[model samples]
Target: MGWLQSLFSPLKKLWFRLHSAPKKRRGIYILYEDVKSCPYEDVHVLWSILVESHTLRTKV
Candidate 1:
């Protein structure tokens, strides 16, 4: 049992390192199928919210 545990210790550390790493953070992406669906008024409201929230990146 001791020998088995010793042999697998390095593998356990590697597994933990691979699994516990932080993933890349992504920002919001809004897509509208119809171009005319989003009106000027609605875009103004969305812009205000994004500004207040400090949105990093937005793809529309």
Candidate 2:
């Protein structure tokens, strides 16, 4: 069992890396800067507005 687990451990890690969400820290600094500059009082509102604008731009 130990040998089987060891043989598959690298494959499991590869699968996880491919399927997982990206690391948040990668873009957290950018998000912090955007939040600092955003005028909306609620961060959720800002996020929705950004999402809407992005969707609109992509659709056009």
Task: Please report the candidate that would top TM-score against the real structure.
Answer: 2
Which whole-number lDDT from 0 to 100 does residue 32 have in model 1?
29
Please provide, for model 1 over 22-56, each residue's C-alpha lDDT reduced to its tens digit, 9 standing for 90 to 100: 86544433432232366677776776676557544
* Predicted model with the maximum lDDT: 2
- Cα-based TM-score, every candidate: 0.35, 0.36
Error of 1 at 43 (Å): 32
Question: Per-residue CA lDDT of candidate 2, range 1-60, in tens?
Answer: 999999999999999998998866753345766787877789867676886887788799
Alpha carbon lDDT of residue 2, candidate 1?
100
Model 1 misplacement above 4 A: 23-60
Alpha-carbon runs more than 4 Å astray in model 2? 25-60
TM-score of model 2 vs. true structure: 0.36
